[model samples]
Target: MTGTDERPDAFARTDDGVSVAYQCRGDEAGRPLVLLAGQANNHHWWDGVREDFHGTARTITLDYRGTGASDAPRDGYSTPRFADDVVGVLDALGIERADVYGTSMGGRVAQWVAARHPERVRRLVLGCTSPGGPLAVERDASVRRALAQPDPDAVRQTLTELMYSPGWIAEHPVPYGTLGDPGMPPHARRGHLVASNRHDAWNALPSVVAPTLILHGDQDRLTPPENVPLLAARIPDARAHLLPGARHAYFEEHREAAGALVREFLG
Candidate 1:
């Protein structure tokens, strides 16, 4: 299935009154796969790789409360809460269970989902993420400073450079825009940042019963490649894979290989 069969964008109201926006595509009869985006990113974050699962999985993507078309509430921003929002979306769509693939902040949220709601996840794929808390390896201060540039354009440029290799960026230049939802308000963006920073799933990871695959780019500086093993060690049934010469956006930069790996694991 493709464009013709894609479901229209819809809203799933969370218990807290935030209406999360989601869309479904790919094979309607195929196994369901939920693609969770990074912090602050909306459903569009999966646009580049979603098609890779077209024939084998019914792909579902959604905008978290503070991003995309979802309502941006002033509070209730945390990784665990984000996980609950995902469950709410599934409940609204009448989906009982699904395979889940999450990258960056989404990966953190996925950890909580599998831990807190094991019955809702058949399999899990965590890409470019960490276990959070003090045990997790953090990026260098320089990388943090670069990303914290006051100018949005500078921050975007820094992110683009950090996410992809120079050759890839030159070959496919991205337009000037925020890496996440461009329309995200200051409060919402801040909420996302805080939520991402506060994520600590170390204690809960051992409770994840779903088989897991951890992917990371060896060259990643934003999330650091070191966190992959930390995650693999915590999850009961998990394996880790690293992509050489890839950065934070390895899933996009190496979509073919990444997609193939995810397909095989989910199958």
Candidate 2:
């Protein structure tokens, strides 16, 4: 509803009764495409990339539980539960299959979806994400400390550095200033982080039958690009793409190029 598309703002109730908010854009009859955001972020973060798929596919973006307009449950915030929320949305919309694109923590959830519900996923795009658990390449202590900053401006500055290349940040000041701020309360944010920390997709990767595209920024500090190849090698039919000079927000920092790659792969 927030995009150029005319679809109404909608909500789908998950099996546990949490209400998940989502929006649909592009051609409904076209291939269904689901966009999942990273940790502490919501569906609105996909605004910058959704336009690229406008006429080619039906783009669906949803708020994970405890973020955006979705109802935050007191518990059950694990990656598996998050994956079920996605499938719940698909079932509510009467979609039999979809191509899923996830970033950061959302990618972990997407892995669960593809592994646990293989019949429902046609393809997967894991951007700036990791396989999770002990196999995941974690950020340095300073980066982790930056994430824990309480000041909004400090948090933004730290995130900009962690997410975008210097050139991209300088060129896109406005977008950088208005980055998607997940309005979850402190407790909810903590819960989300806990869920992220618990994600373990290593065992599930080999079972994901859907063809996968693992895209990462060459300069990503949060999830090192080295994890890309390791992740690709684990999946049966996975491809890895390293965007030169881009950071964790590679898809956003290199919007046109990254979007083109996604379009080509999804086509």
Candidate 3:
């Protein structure tokens, strides 16, 4: 199947028989960099910022079970399972290990990837994500209410506000694809929501052996900035950085600086 970018999609069948779709781009000789997207989002979540890594790494992106070209089973939607899907992709591609970067819910999955399969991750970058659970700081009540708004327009507006600053959004009046997979089924969406909500990687976080970098936006209202220290404290030797004046989509809002930081760290 061809993806939105017209690249042919590759398939990897999970142990449970679900087919996950992935796409690879950039320098073939470059090191592999696996990018995990946020809640309900497909590979396109990185559309705005993925090219920044192309010069130095082969960027790999995939759709979760319910999104994009992947098969959506009624069951198996937890972060750990999502991590397993990532491993399936790597195994199918004959990649033994690679650098990993995840954002939002994808970061939650990356936590499991590094923790459960430490041998498969060379370095880790967690962007605009929380550790998830009581130890992690959550969004404010107002933000939560806005996110839960029933109207699609309201949700998009809320997401836009949460993702980028007013100035940035005004300057770049284009879609960031934050709405996730347009064709996602209701069950898959619900599963993603439940899985992300129930994510509790506190006990497993210490097991993550990969060198980790935790990045967040100082002005973020979605995940909040306070969670960065909490994540850094749990993951041994983890470094934390905050992007000034950025929100949830800090990686996209400040791509140059964020990309430089990632490139340097991975190198």
Which portions of model 1 show Cα errors greater than 4 Å? Answer: 3-6, 176-178
Give the whole-model CA lDDT for all candidates, comma-separated: 0.90, 0.85, 0.91
Give the alpha carbon lDDT tens digit for every residue of 13-117 in model 3: 999999999999877778999999999999989888887887788889999999999999999999999999999999999999999999999999999999999
User: How well is each residue in 241-267 modelled by candidate 2, as lDDT tens digits?
Assistant: 999888888888788889999989998
* Candidates 1 and 2 compared by lDDT, better number: 1
Clashing pairs in 3: none
What residue pairs clash in candidate 2, if any at all? none
lDDT of 1 by residue, 61-149 (tens): 89889888889999989999999999998998899999999999999999999999999999999999999999999999999999888
Residue pairs in candidate 1 whose N, alpha carbon or C atoms collide under 3 angstroms: none
| Best candidate according to lDDT | 3
Residue 249 miss distance in model 2 (angstroms) = 0.8
Better of 2 and 3 by lDDT: 3
